[model samples]
Target: MSLVVTPLELPERWDEPGPRGDAFRAFHAHAERSNAMRFGPDVVARSPEERLASLQPSLAEACRAFVAHRDGQLVGALKVYTPLLESTDVAEIVISAEPDLPDAEVLDLVEELTTHGEQVAAGLGRGDFRGGSLAAASGAVTAATGFGGVDPDHPEVAPLVARGYVLEQVYRISMVDLAALPDLDERLAAARAGAPGYDVVAWAGETPAPHRAGMCRLKEQMAADAPGGGVLFEPEVWDDARLADFEASAASGGRTIRTVAAVEGATGELVGFTSAFVGTSTVVNQQDTVVAGAHRGHGLGALMKLANLAELREHHPNHTRVVTWNAEENRPMLAVNEATGFVTVVHDGVWKRRSVS
Candidate 1:
């Protein structure tokens, strides 16, 4: 069958629901299924409306998405995004294929998509870009630099290596079963004894006006504090405007973000925090957890994580598991996760290439 490649016509059918837009829904379903394979379903969990919102242009990233069709069926998709935050010289691309596609056809489609991605990157004043493709293992997404070389194990790694990409980072994927979660009472108590000056604060949805300023600062701390593992990164700066934009986007996508934070009783400042997101999906996704440097050794990180997880479980008892990813070098956070019942399920690699376009 001949394959046709074109820009995804979002406005033409994205809003059509149910019987009215079978084609649009078909593409969306394909994307969701493909994402479930690349990242765990819980990690990429999103309704079609939420997924659609993600594909739309954002102030932080302008995306150009494309789909490949064969025999009137959507077989593959490629999304290229140029970050407005940092890495102006770089772009990020995600490519996926229908599970049943022949290897040759998948390669052809990906090659075409990569070519298009490079064009977009060039238009954005970037000399090179990165692309992430599903590797051979489950829950393993491999990234390549310069639109090419990536994790050695991914099926597409060879092509990328030939194109000058090389492995840069490995991130371990971990999961915790909520049913078997051990008692955190002992840990929480010990942590609280040492951090008696700090109290836990819990919230659902947007932060309260009183805590908004502190939450913003804590988010920035999370970015600055997390281990980068050698990829180009710019610390994401956050403020009321950005946080509101984030909440609005999450709402539009049918998501609820729940957070737990440790506040300094004396200053009313958020010193550490953890976030978990649940939407229409059964699996909860653990996002950022960070403690300000000044509050590090006091066990506030573990306290914040434990408090949030308990609060989350109480509200969403049906959520079977929680999933999170950590860079291999982030031993402290990994230790906290391991102690809390998280087990490594898969490993993902991030790769980089330069001036390949």
Candidate 2:
């Protein structure tokens, strides 16, 4: 098969009439196909407008896209993201191809896309290229955290391994049936009674100006405290401007960010927070949940999640499920999620390859 790879020239608008518009639609289609193959046919995919809006660069990262074609038809797409806030040495690459193709053809596309990814990373002065793929937990290759494994024969895994990428970590991807949640009212009451001097507050979209800095600090702390296993994730730098950029970008993509945070009653500072990103689909993505080290063990994590779920149900009644990813070793967060109604569906492997200097 003669496959041609070309950089995708992003159009100024999603509805623009041209070859770029066609490529944009094809890129989203490839992603949807890949998602269905990896997660199942029921997976909710980003709409074309949402996908285009998501490509907008933010203060944290900039993305570049590429497309692969065979016989003038798109067969694969690649996205490379370079972090601007922190972890500047790393480039995150996501590549996917048509699922109907044979393994050999799939690997060929993978190889070609990975080479393009590496070249992009080199041009950006990045030394580490990182990628992740979702797979069943029962497999021969175990994660560093000892909780999940990926079958070596999995299409996504084989290509990365063949390309010399080491499995750094595995994240448990869980789905929460909002309707089937464990007596959250009881759980919330118990969690609140167990913890004193903290009040849980919920908000949608932009963060209140007073809590913005606290939210930034909490985000930075989350980046520092989260389990990394072998993946070298640097502590992210977050400020008011960066936070605004995040909210703006999400709003542009038609995503509503619902946040539930625990505030110190005396100091009026945010101590822990949980966020849910809701799009037009029925699925809501649980983005981040973290508690400050000093405030740990007070049941703030569960309280925030319970409050967030309440907010989600009250405001976004159309959404039926919530999905989240947690490091296999993140027992605290995992426990909170499991107790709330989340069950593991699959495990995602984080693979990294460092350039040889």
Best by TM-score: 2
Candidate 1 per-residue lDDT over residues 81-163, each given as its tens digit: 78777667778767788887877777777776776777777877887467654332222333322121234444555455556
Superposed by TM-score, candidate 2 places the C-alpha of residue 176 at a distance from the truth, in angstroms, of 0.7
Superposed by TM-score, candidate 2 places the C-alpha of residue 124 at a distance from the truth, in angstroms, of: 1.6
**CA deviation > 4 Å runs, candidate 2:** 41-44
Candidate 1, after superposition: displacement of residue 335 in Å? 1.2
- Off-target runs (Cα >4 Å) in candidate 1 are 1-3, 11-23, 39-43, 134-153, 185-187
Number of the predicted model whose lDDT against the real structure is largest: 2
Question: Cα lDDT of all candidates, in order?
Answer: 0.73, 0.84
Across residues 1-60, which tens digit of lDDT does each residue of candidate 2 receive?
A: 688888888787777898888788788888888877876654456777788888878888
- Write down the RMSD of all candidates, one decimal each: 3.9, 1.6
TM-score of each: 0.87, 0.95
Measured with C-alpha atoms, the lDDT of residue 132 in candidate 2 is 76
lDDT for 357 (candidate 2): 60
